[model samples]
Target: MNNPYNVLCIGVNHVPVRRLSKLDYAEKDAKTVAKYFDTLKDKAHVTLLTGENATRTNVLNWVKQCSNIQGKLTVIIFFAGHGSAEKDENNKKLERCLWINSNLDTGPGSHQLKTSEILNLLNNPLHQLIFLIDACYNFDPKQEVSIQDIFKQFKESERMTGLKQYAIISASAVNQGALEDPQLGHGVLTYYFLQTMAGKYTFFLRRKISFFRFLAVLDKRVRNHRFLTDT
Candidate 1:
C-alpha cells in the first residue's frame, strides 16, 4: 500500500557490553510499536530496525535516503533504548545522544548517534518530523544538572534552526528515571503509549488524538502507577 508518511522504529534491546545491562523488553517494545504502525499500512510505510541492524551507519543511511525522497512526507522516529550525554572537557553538556549499539566509549567508533545528527540528516526534505524517545536523559547521578535543564538546553539549540513542524516526546522529567514495568512486560512509557494508540482508553476512542494529547494522558497514567527504575 502506498502511504504518504514514513515511520522508522528503532529499538535497542541488547547492548553487547558488560558495563551496560540489557533491556530485555526493548525488542518487544520495538516490535509492538512497529506492529502498531503496520496496522496503519494504508496510511504509512513503516520500517523496523532493531538489535544488530540498528547500527549508527544503518540508521544514518536510512535517514539520508529518506531525506532525498521528493514529496510532502512526514517522518517519525521512535527509539527505545539507552540515552546518554557526555560532558565536554570544560564540563559543559554536549548533545544528548542515542546509543545505537553496545559501545560505551564516547568516541567516533562508539556507534552512538546524536539527536543533532538526526536533525541535520533529515533537514529540508520532509514536511514534518517527530521524535519519540523512551530512554533516560542523564544516567549519571553525579552530573548535578537535571535532565529537564539539559532538555531545555537541547530545545534551545533546536529552536535556532527555525524548524516549526516537529515535536519531541521524551518519557521522563528532570532527575526522574524512565522506568519499566516488569508485570506489563514493556517499558512504562511504551506501554501507555501503545495503550492510548490502541484506544484502550475509552475517552480517546473516537477522537483524532494529537501527540500532545497522548502525552498528557500518558503522564497521568505513569504518575498513577508504580514503575521500576531503568537500571
Candidate 2:
C-alpha cells in the first residue's frame, strides 16, 4: 500500500429509488472497471467499490483516507450512473453529478450531488486527481431544461481552480449520449479504455504515451464496434 499511487474504482450498480429503470449492464460495468485496476494491483494499491450497495459515505472515505499523502497520488473517480443538469436563481448553470443512489425525481439539491461539491472534496493538496464521468444528462429540448442549458450558465474555469493537475475526462462529447451495451457489459468508452490499457499501457508522459494517444486507440475501437449504441 506504500506505492504512492492509489486507484479506487467506485462502480455503483444499484439505484436508491425502487421501481426505477435499472442499468442492464451495471454489474458487468463495475466488474470490468475493477478488473482494470486489478492489473495495477502489483504496482499500486487498488480498491474496487462496486454493486448497488455502494454509498457516498464509502466513496468520500476512500478519497479522504486512502489517498497517499507523501507521494504522487493519482486518484481516479469513475462513475457509470445517471447524471443531470440544473439551473440556479440567477440563471446560472450547474452540473448535477448524480450518484447511483440519486433520486432524479426530486427537486433541485434533493438527491443529487453538485459537481462543485465533489470537486471541493479534492481541493486538499494531493498528488493529483482525475475524474472520469461516464454519465450523460437526458435533455428534453421542448422543456427548455436541456442538460447543455444548465451547463452553459456557469463558467468551469472559475470552479476548476485549486485543483492542481486535475483533469476531467468525460465519456461523451458535447450533446452525445453515453453508450452502454448489455453484451459488452460496460459503457462503450470504458470498455475501450480498458482494452487499450490492457497490456502495460503507459499512464504518464515519461512513458512516451500521451493520454490523447491512448484515447485515440479507444475511439477507434468504439467506432469499429458494430453493436455500439451511441450516435
Candidate 3:
C-alpha cells in the first residue's frame, strides 16, 4: 500500500449497444493484469474496473482525482477493451479512441474516449501518465489512422511547460488488429506484457533493460503472435 504506483486496470467484455460484438476475454484480461499486481503487493493501490463499472464517467472521475494527489506518482491506465478510430471534425482525418461503456448510438465522442481527451484530463505535473491500450483497430480502411500519428499530434511544443511524461503502448501496429485466442484466455498484448515483467525471456540488452528495451521484447512477441488473431 505504500508503493508509488497507482494502477487502474479496466476491461470491458461487452458494450450495451446491440451493434458491437461480444468479446470473450476482455474482462478476464483486465482481472489477469490486476491479479498480477495484487500478487506483487507492492503498489500504492490497484483499482480494477471491469464490466459496467468502467463507464466513461467513472473512469474520468478517477483520472480527475489523480491531479489532486500532490506528490510524485506513476498512474497507469491499463485498458484491455476495444480501440477504434473516429473521423475528425473536418471529416478528413481519423483519431484513435478507446471505447468504454456507453448506451448512446451517436458518433465517436458520445461513447468513446479519444487519446487527445485523455491527455487533456491527465495533464498534471505531479503524476506521470502511462496508457496501455489493447484494442483492435485499423484493420479497415476507414479507420486506417495509425496510433503513431495520433500520438504525434500531442507532441505540441506548448506541452513542454509542465507536463511530466506521457507514454502510450498499443497492442497492434498501423494495420494490424489487437489479437486474442480462447486457448490463452488473455489478449496477446497482456500475455506478453506479463511475460516481459516476469522476466520469462532474456533480452540481448539484459544488463540494464530500459523501458524502450522492454517494449522491444513485447513488440517482437506481438508481431509474431501464434494465434488466430494477429497484432
State every prediction's TM-score relative to the real structure: 0.79, 0.74, 0.78
lDDT of 2 by residue, 1-231 (tens): 555456666565556544335666655666677666666566667676666345566666676664425555666666676555544446455445555553235544444556566666665464577666666544334345654554564344221122346766665543445667766667776776676776455553224476666656655676676344433
* Predicted candidate 1 versus true structure: per-residue lDDT over 1-231, tens digit per residue: 135768888999777644557887777888898887777577778888899888887788778877887778878788898776645435466556777773345554275677878888888544578777777665455556665657766654331122486667666533345666788898877888788777744222234756556657766776666433422
* Model 2 pairs whose backbones collide: 14-52
lDDT of 2 at 79: 69
lDDT of 3 at 226: 47
Q: For candidate 3, report its TM-score.
A: 0.78
Cα lDDT tens digits for candidate 3, 35-149: 7767645544788999878877778778877766777887777898877656676754556677788645656467677767767887777778767888865524555566665
Q: Count the backbone clashes (under 3 Å) in each candidate.
A: 0, 1, 0
Q: Where does candidate 2 stray beyond 4 Å?
A: 18-20, 66-68, 88-91, 102-110, 139-164, 199-208, 223-231
Instruction: Name the lDDT of candidate 2.
Output: 0.58
Evaluated with TM-score, which candidate comes out highest?
1
Q: Rate the local accuracy (lDDT) of all candidates.
A: 0.69, 0.58, 0.69
